[model samples]
Target: MVYKMLVLNIDGTLLQDNGRINKMTREAIEFAQSKDIKVILSTSKNFPAAKRVAKTLKVDNHIVSHQGGYIAKELNKPVYVNKIDEKITSEITTFLESFSCQIKLVHEQFSLGNKVKLPENILAKVVFQRTNRFSYSEQYVDNLSEKLQEGPVSPPKIEAAFDNNANLSDAKKAIEEMYDEVTCIEVGDNKLDIVAAGVSKLNGVKYLCEQHGIKRGEVVAIGAGIDDLPLVQWAGLGVAMGNAPAIVRSAANWNTRTNNDNGVAYMVKEHFRKQYKLEFLKKINVLK
Candidate 1:
């Protein structure tokens, strides 16, 4: 079947483990776009971070960010925004402070996080990722709750990283039991992204599809994280990176090479190459 859109996850699916997009992957994305396919980047990162990657790849399409809490094509104009209430934002950050984890209140244009003393190496993991310098700003404080109390904030997402799985699990459960309006998504072993309830990467992409008159059955979704499972399973063509967890791979319609090996490039080339061939055959009246 012919696909109209390609949805991608940024971290482990589009970027290699070292946090760079390979040349082959870049060209392959271009190839798909050349076929008039719309490619959308669906990521758990904030808007600015996702925008930076799109700008780097030269993809100007709308992006799904903040774990599907925000969707925008341009910095100033948001197609959609699902933000946590300012009061709830304050309470959530306040509660999260008790846990042994770093907390970040993610807004559309800025992020306010708590200043937690930790080794440089560990800090790098939480802070050093893709960012758009002009459109996004990040500030750390002695206390996030105090910062919020100074001014109410309706952020699109709240992010946290725990020191261990036990803390992660307990925090997730406690948050769920306490708030009916929010949902905590465990993005990794000990990382969580909290957003409004019913907000998900799948629903975000679905909204985009509806806006563009595309159907769920005419989309290709690729991802590697636990947060990616729903979309990966629901897309017309679901692909898992070789680096994806075993469960994700098993759920996918196809599995490509690891991110380090240019998984995206492999899948895109192989899939579209066949489509191109079929088109050529039909043009020559070789196949109906």
Candidate 2:
């Protein structure tokens, strides 16, 4: 089957440990473009981070960020924004505060509400400090607390990261029980994402398809995290990375090599190249 475009998730799916796009991945994207296949980046990261990746790839297309809470064209032009209403947000915030979970609020603009001061690398460390664990340095704790004090009022998205899986799980359960009005998704073992009801990666993909006049069958969605499950199921060809969790793998139509092993490249080569060749052959026979 031929697909009109490919939708990719960043972080664990596209970038390796060092946060750089691998050479093989770049070549694969170029190969797809050569065949006239559009590549759209769908990520949980904010627009600034996603924009950096898009610039590196040199593709001006749609990006699904905040795990479907936001969709934008290029870096600054927002095509869609799905935010938790203030009532739900306030309730969730109160519930989370009772459990000592620090929250980060992401807004429509690039600005972050509840913006913490620690460097991006030390965010995990800060969480550890809050939990009174040996995991975080004092510097991280100090920075985080300081940032929390200088707050922004309203944000579009909320993220809570914990030091241990048990704590994260407890928080997830607590939120589900206390605030039944919102949707809470576990992104990985250590992080919990709270969003408005009816928001998800699937919604983001559908919105993009509708805006661009592309059909569901024309999309190839790829990812490796739990948050990606909705997208994997929604796309015509749902691909799971070898490194994906068992649940994600089971949800997908096909499993590819791990992202570290250029899994995305392999899929593009196998699917798009064959389609391109068949189309070329058809054109040749028609001309004859």
Candidate 3:
């Protein structure tokens, strides 16, 4: 079968456990691109975070980031962005403040949050450091809700991380129930990502498909994360990593090896080998 697009989730599907793309995975991606398949990264990470990895992989296709709220060709320019309403964002921010967590708002030019304080939890600090190290613009604020309102721009996504899994689950449930206008996705036991209603990695992939005139059946999605389930389920060929959670794996049509085991390469090589042989045979006039 021919695939017009290959949508990969960044954190767990494309990147290995070492937080870098392995040589085999890189070669597989390059091979897919060489075959004229559009390889896109549909991730929950911010544009800069995703762009860094995309550059390393040499994927020139557009990326879907911020959990599908941001679709951009590059970090500097977005083809489309679904930003949360300012009032709704304020309400969500106010609601999340009740929980003991750090809130981060991802904007086009910069990110601002109260969690930038030095005394925040290790996870919060690690997140901040990673963004800073990548040189993604960032700043601090006293009240994110108020500061967000002060500016004309609304963030594409809001993230909250708690120290305890119970509180995080409760907060995620509460937000999902209370904020009916927004979609909440639990990234892990202690974190939740919020985006506009009806927004998701699947939506992002669908948008790209429409723009390119590619049908749903011509797309392949591979991922291993809580937020990746919908995208994986929606693609024509959905593959889940061995390391993916059971739910994610269950959502996929097939399960591949784990990310650390070069799952992306294994799947890609196997999927494209048939097509490659057919083309080679046709070139030699051995097959119609």
Candidate 4:
């Protein structure tokens, strides 16, 4: 069957170093639109952050954010949202308290609350590390008092970043034990995300498809993280990045070059080249 649209994850799959969109990638997305292929941005980032990237890509399709818990039209007009239950949030807060972990909760966006203020350098490292293992580091904890002093905001989503090799077995085990009520998703090797049960990238994609009359098989999902596994699995065609984890590569139907290498352009060109060729063949047969 012919594909109709493309879905891309931001952080690792679209943006290269320093969260900037490379020139080749930008041109590729524009070319896809020139071919009438709709492009969607599916990311774990909040709507605001995703909107910036979406604007850069000139994409007007549905935006999937919060790992699929929230979907909006044009970043500001939300059509659907799947938030974690309040009780679950309370329980998670209590659970993390024991470990003294500073969690960033995401409601509609990054929830402002008692989160520890991480230095810009540390924040950069956390984004790069993509894990929750850093929560166990003394340095992270040392900044907690300053973070708490800044006050709190209610976040429906909670994220903890820790250094690589931090022992998080206990946290993982605890979360698993409560799996029936909460879902603990690892974003990368070092970051842990706890959202309400049944909220994931797959759920968000499904919601978008239903609202837009797009079928699961008509969409192409591209990603490079553990959180994107479900989306890749659910898409009609799953395209993983060359820099993706081994597991992600194994799961996708095709593996493209790294984002910095213009992977998006390659896939977009391939999709349309095949489509145009097929259309050309069909016209030829009809004329005969």
Candidate 5:
């Protein structure tokens, strides 16, 4: 089947382990654009971070960010958004303060996080990963729930990072049990993103597709994290990076090379090449 859209995850699928896009990957994405396939970036990051990557790729389409809580072509105009209610946000932040994790409330433009001391290494890997080179400023306060009390905030997403897996699991379970208005999703190891109930990367993409007149069977999705599993399984061509975990690879229709190995470049080129060859053969009446 012909694919009309390409959904790419930012961290592991597009950027290499070194936090940069490979040259061949950029070229492949350009090639896909030349073929008229709209490339949409879907990430757990806020818009600015995603925009930095989009600007690099010269992608002028809508972006799916905040773990699909926000979708917008530009910062001021949002096609869709599902923000956590201010009251619920306050309650959740208060509840989360009891856990041994760093709490952050993410809006479309900025992030407000609680000041929690963490190891330099873990901070770099978890919090800083999405915040690096971000155009928006991040403010850290002594308390997040108290900050919310100053003013009502309907943040699109809330994040919690834990140093221990046990804490992460416990926090996720507790949040789910306590709050019916939000869904806690495990994005990576010891990291959870809280969004409105029923919000997911797949549903985010689906919402965009509906607005653009696209179909579920006409999309190709690539991802490496557990948060990406729903879209990977739902897309017509679900691709798992070689660097992806075994479970993600097992769910995908195809598995490409590792992020460091130019997985995205390889996958995009191969799929389109086969499409071109099939079209040529059909034109020549070799097989119909």
Candidate 6:
């Protein structure tokens, strides 16, 4: 089957372990774009952060961020969004605060939250190291629940980070049990993103496909985390990064080399080199 759309996950799936895109990966994406495949970035990050990556790749397609609760062509304006109920958001924030975790309210443009001062917290430390991880500005608020209660808005999602995976897992279980209006998804080891029930990267991918008139069977998804399960399973062809955990790899159709080893490039060359012709080389006005 011919694939028309390629869904990319930024962190571990596309970028190498040191947090940069490799030359081979960059060239492969350009090659795919030359073939007219719709490339969409699906991430747990907010739209702005995703935009930076898109800019690097020169990709202008709609971005799927906030774990798929938010979608937009630009940072300030969202084309689609699914936020948790206002009342529930307040309740959820209140509950999350009790866990001594840093909570960030994820909106389309700016995230409102307090700076995590928990140095002993592993997630907070990583978050500090990667302040640009989220696509929006993080505005710290003392009383997030009160702020949510006072506002006419409920954020698309709330991401809470902890020191350990066990704490996050427990928090996820508790949050799920307490509020049926939202879904708690563990995007990484110690970070949990809470969004409206049923929001996921698969939902984001489905929306993009519908907009582009593509079908599920014509989609190619790549990911390397717990949050990637749905899209990996739904897409016609799912590729897991070699750096991905065994469970995520098991869920996919196949595995590519680790991102550091030019996994994306390998996948593209192995699968598409024969199926699709490269005409990009002919378009350049070369002088002999």
Q: What would the per-residue lDDT of candidate 2 be over residues 17-56, giving only the tens digit for each residue?
A: 5567888888888888777677888877766667668878
Residue lDDT tens for model 3, 1-288: 567788999887898876889999999999888777889999888888888889999987899999999999876678888988888878888887777777888875677777433334546423433565447777767776677668744788988877778887887788788877888888874778889988899998899899988888878899998889888888899999999999989889889999999999999998876665435555888645
| Candidate 6 vs. true structure, TM-score | 0.87
lDDT (C-alpha, whole model) for all candidates = 0.87, 0.71, 0.82, 0.70, 0.88, 0.80
User: Which ranges of candidate 1 are over 4 A from the true structure?
Assistant: 119-133, 277-288
Give lDDT tens digits, candidate 4, residues 200-279.
Answer: 77787777677767788888999988888888888999999988898999999989999778787788777666564324
Off by over 4 Å in 4: 74-76, 113-124, 128-156, 164-166, 277-288
lDDT of 1 at 231: 96
- Cα-lDDT of candidate 2: 0.71
**Runs off by more than 4 Å, candidate 2:** 100-102, 108-152, 178-181, 277-288
Worst lDDT 10-window in candidate 4? 130-139
Instruction: Provide C-alpha RMSD values for all models, in order.
Output: 2.8, 6.4, 3.4, 6.2, 3.1, 5.1
Residues 106-222, candidate 1: write the lDDT tens digits. Answer: 888898888787556556666335355566888889978888878889988998988777988998999999999999888875789999998999999999999988888889999
Q: Higher-TM-score candidate among 5 and 6?
A: 5
Which parts of model 6 have CA positions greater than 4 angstroms off?
Answer: 119-121, 124-135, 141-143, 146-153, 277-288
lDDT of 6: 0.80
lDDT of residue 286 for candidate 4: 32
Clashes of 6: 2
Candidate 4 versus the native: TM-score?
0.80
lDDT of 6 by residue, 1-288 (tens): 767889999888777777788888888888888777888999987777778888888889999988898898887678788888878877777887777677888776677775555655474345422347444466777777777766745888888887677778888888888877888887775778889988898998898899878889889899988789888888999999898888889999979999889998999878776545324432552211
Which whole-number lDDT from 0 to 100 does residue 163 have in model 4? Answer: 39
Ranking of all predicted structures according to lDDT, beginning with the best and ending with the worst: 5, 1, 3, 6, 2, 4
Clashing pairs in 3: none
Residue pairs in collision within model 2: none
